[model samples]
Target: MKKSLITSLAAVLLLSATAATAQQKSMGGMQDMPMGKPATGQSVHMARGKVTKVDAGANLVTLAHEPVKSLNWPAMTMGFQVKDKMLLDKLTVGRMVDFEFAQAGKGYAITGVK
Candidate 1:
């Protein structure tokens, strides 16, 4: 009986560990991979934030954005590359924007803004 009980307990522990690993993967394992790189099929995320800075010459915009639920990110300020330099024309420091972005090579890229 003791042997059977030990086997059952071990099985349960193994299953629990497997579940935890799966949960971490589903959560994006962001710490293991570069930030903004989502798992397959999670291509886009929407966020709203104030434009903190715009580097038109580099096509980058820095924003103090609200939490990004899709990416499981808390509110934070970060820079994103714009898909087009022209997108910079619509962004101004201190202005609030609603934007859509996707994971680019090693960073995030803004696909649209409103």
Candidate 2:
């Protein structure tokens, strides 16, 4: 009876370990990588830009930004969606800012601005 109990316990442990590994694999190996997106666990990219325009009603801000090395984006003028409209409260035309953002959907969305 003792041997049978020990054997059954060992089998249960092995099965549990195997199932955990399989579940992780099914979920994309312990990390999710969204399509056309940067690698997981990487820091969000930061860049410096000057605000060129603000449209609070539309929840957009246009910026003339410097190059973002991590994202390989060049200096240019572009409009970005504000994730939180309050982040746009202090932004105005011609104000210099240090900001962070991530690519979302088909455009860039500002994660922060200062």
Candidate 3:
């Protein structure tokens, strides 16, 4: 009975390990990525959108943007943190823009706008 118990425990351990590995892989190895900071050399995502709001005090700009193919994101209106407050100067309510951004912490940060 002891031998059978040990075998069952080993099987459970093996299954647990397999599940953990699969979850990590499915997340694209983000398990090791840090939160609250942008990853070094992260890919830039581009999108076109109309400025819905620009809050310079908070260094944020809200956009009603087109579908972002790089991130497989559907068209949506969302707020993005700017890399710097100066970026906010370029944004105005009701203005159309082409922008570049990178993943930042649990959100996205705009790197440039045109």
Candidate 4:
């Protein structure tokens, strides 16, 4: 019985070790890539969604959004600036825009609107 117990314990240890290694390998794959600083001259292709709120006073536009084919986002609604207030003239609540822009001294500012 002692021999059997020892063997079972050893098997459990081996399986746990294997699992730990696999988990480590998987986590290693998700490590953030080092690029020194965020990419420059980067244009964000905003996700397809309608504007939820437009606060011109704050120079902020909130969007009920999905993933932008050109940018990576995980939220449904987001607030970003219209690169130029002129772009605001073109956008309306509930309208969709395939906008492009990059981060500036403040939040994101529009570089292009389509």
For model 1, residues 1-114, the per-residue Cα lDDT tens digits are: 967865555454345435534554676655432234444444777889999877675577778899877666767777777887778887999999998887666566788888
TM-score (all chains, Cα) for each model:
0.64, 0.61, 0.65, 0.53
Please give the ranking of all candidate structures by TM-score, highest first, separated by commas: 3, 1, 2, 4
State the C-alpha lDDT per candidate: 0.71, 0.66, 0.69, 0.55
In candidate 3, which residue pairs get closer than 3 Å at backbone N, Cα or C atoms, i.e. clash?
none
RMSD of 4: 19.0
For model 4, the superposed segments whose C-alpha errors exceed 4 Å read: 1-40, 69-71
Candidate 2 residue-wise lDDT, 15-108, digit = tens: 5435533544564524423223334333466789999877676667777889766654557666776888889876788899988776555456
Model 2: residues with Cα > 4 Å off, grouped in runs: 1-43
Best prediction by lDDT? 1
Q: Rank the candidates by lDDT, best first.
A: 1, 3, 2, 4
- RMSD values, in order shown: 17.4, 20.4, 16.5, 19.0
For candidate 3, which ten residues in a row score worst on lDDT? 29-38
Better of 2 and 4 by lDDT: 2
Candidate 3 residues 1-114, lDDT tens each?
967865555454345435534544575624232222335677777889999866665577778899776655557777777897777878999999999887676566798888
List the pairs of residues colliding in candidate 4.
47-68, 65-76, 83-110
Task: Give me candidate 4's TM-score against the actual structure.
Answer: 0.53
Sequence-dependent TM-score of model 3: 0.65
